[model samples]
Target: MKKYTLLLLTIAATVVILIQSILYIKAGASAGKTSGVPAESLARLSEQVSVRAARRGNPWINLRDGRDLVAELTGADQGLLAGEGLAEPMALASDDFDEDGTPDLVTAHRAAQGGVLSFYRGNVDAVYPNAPEAKARKAAGSYTDAPFLSPGRLLATAEPPDLLGAGDFDADGHRDIVAAARGGSSIYVLSGDGRGGFPRSKQIQLPGRVTALTAGEINRADGLADIIVGISTQDGARALVFEDLRGAIKAAPESHALPATATDFALGDFVDGYETDLAIASGSQLLVLHGRDRRSAKQSRPRITSRRFSSAIESLATGNFTGSHRFEVGVLSEEGEIAALTPVKVKSKN
Candidate 1:
């Protein structure tokens, strides 16, 4: 008899929880309808909930309130390399530098001669035995001979580059190195010779000090990749698009003034379009410049949208960060918190 009473109480409590949940949802719906909450706000709230559910299984980040910022923590506590004589690491970039189907890492450190680039090769075979590169290389009997640090090679720059980026800037088959000099108005494009060497570097002068650097096909008609740089002048912050013409950069770049001083920026397909857009972070505000399609007029400016955050953003990164088909923007806060922002769906005016 006592056991039966305890079981009844457990079921009763479960029923009460379900009842309260339904009531709470209904009350929220009623309040939303009566309190004149904007449809966009409701849509954002619904999307936040969806984002949380989608990211709940991710082991790296703790997406507590979906869109809210939280400090990111990793399981490992040890460093990758130690006592390598690297001083004051400034920027880092990564890509498959060798075309060996393994992603490599490049870190820039402050050096006496400007910035030093450290190349760390990726070991796909050792790390992932079943990876495509591993299988193909094994089948062909072509194994990597050396470890990550390619024995006697060192890359250095003339100026201390605050921002580092990788892309085929000259439309060459091999990817090249791109860096923006800190506190200076010069952008360097170091051409990769495809055999683990940078043969030459081209310097492009900008209007002001470079704050950020990124590469994309901003002007699709050119059939080449262009470099977009964020600059800060006495007037304000601005974005410049330097068109790549037949493996050479244009002397005069097209510039657009930003609303605020950009701390960092990235280029990605953030909105519902095939064209790449720009995401800029200025203090606590996030501004997006929507890219124009091929059919649009060339002289028209991009449509910009601004969103304010509670904390100041330190930097901006572009990727499929939210596990969505379209690329989203991930921001790092001054307090070391991380958050993601995706394109929000809105009703068409037509």
Candidate 2:
């Protein structure tokens, strides 16, 4: 009887150990896998809720649900101040076109057929930014005294574009507007008159529909501003560089194809003194293409390096977040988390 009891006790102990082992394996599988750049190589500074909902611009200014929000960034602290009673905006772009030192604002709203572009000339005034009055006047459509004076809507499009970008594409000292049609292959350029007017729009055709669009000096030697557009192709999403060729009606742009595919992208000089690098959101990864200086030799395609983020990135924005003069990328995750990511020096040779 004693021998049989001892054998039963040993079997019970073995069963308990087996159960614990299985539970441990199950927990490990449920945790998921962590991949991408190591913590020492890339740092996530902060997660902001406001940034996740922002449509365009950096922390200083951004558009949220047709409302314009302004914030003051002081060191590590940031506060958002939103304007009320403004007309509903679908897209926003800003630049100092008139050389007034203050950046001007441009907004696009949905029209019946397509979209309507509006320009707001920037003016600096001590009393113009009064919080209560600006909001009230904006509702009445007579906020001329406010910081952004509306010159009224400038141009209309045949099909409403999903994205808006501004740059001096012609090198004519005024920023022109680039609009990418939603789920369409054509991109439209409306030349800015430097006085808040766009008389006409020129169409540039692409092979595939545009997914994301941004304006930057992709080719510094060209002297004319260029645009980087993420387009959907037969295989997958691809990035294309469209060089602004001055003066050609319905011209086929001198385009360069980048190797990386992206759902959203932003241009910035990630490494100082190098050509502009691309921060791309493709799949669930963030790719950084360290641009090659094409001026010296044959311009080869930029090499892509990637970091798999915890969550899929929905949108990307670039800004000088660290005061390091180098621009960092702000990624809005699909899970509604916003993280500011900057690359750090790698220590391990591997």
Per-candidate alpha-carbon RMSD to the true structure: 20.0, 23.5
Q: List the residue pairs that clash in candidate 1.
A: none
Q: Which candidate wins on lDDT?
A: 1
lDDT by residue for model 1 (203-246), tens: 98887988777766663444556677888898998988766455
lDDT against the true structure, each candidate: 0.64, 0.59
lDDT of 2: 0.59
- After superposing candidate 2 on the true structure, give the runs of residues whose Cα lies further than 4 Å from its correct spot: 1-88, 98-101, 126-145, 219-223, 244-261, 294-298, 322-326, 344-350
After superposition, candidate 1 runs with Cα above 4 Å error:
1-86, 127-149, 219-224, 245-248, 294-297, 319-326, 335-338, 344-350
TM-score of each: 0.65, 0.63
Clashes of each: 0, 0
lDDT of 2 by residue, 46-158 (tens): 23343444656676677643323221212111111023322235688888655444577766655545665656556432133344434443454433333443222345566
lDDT of 1 at 325: 64
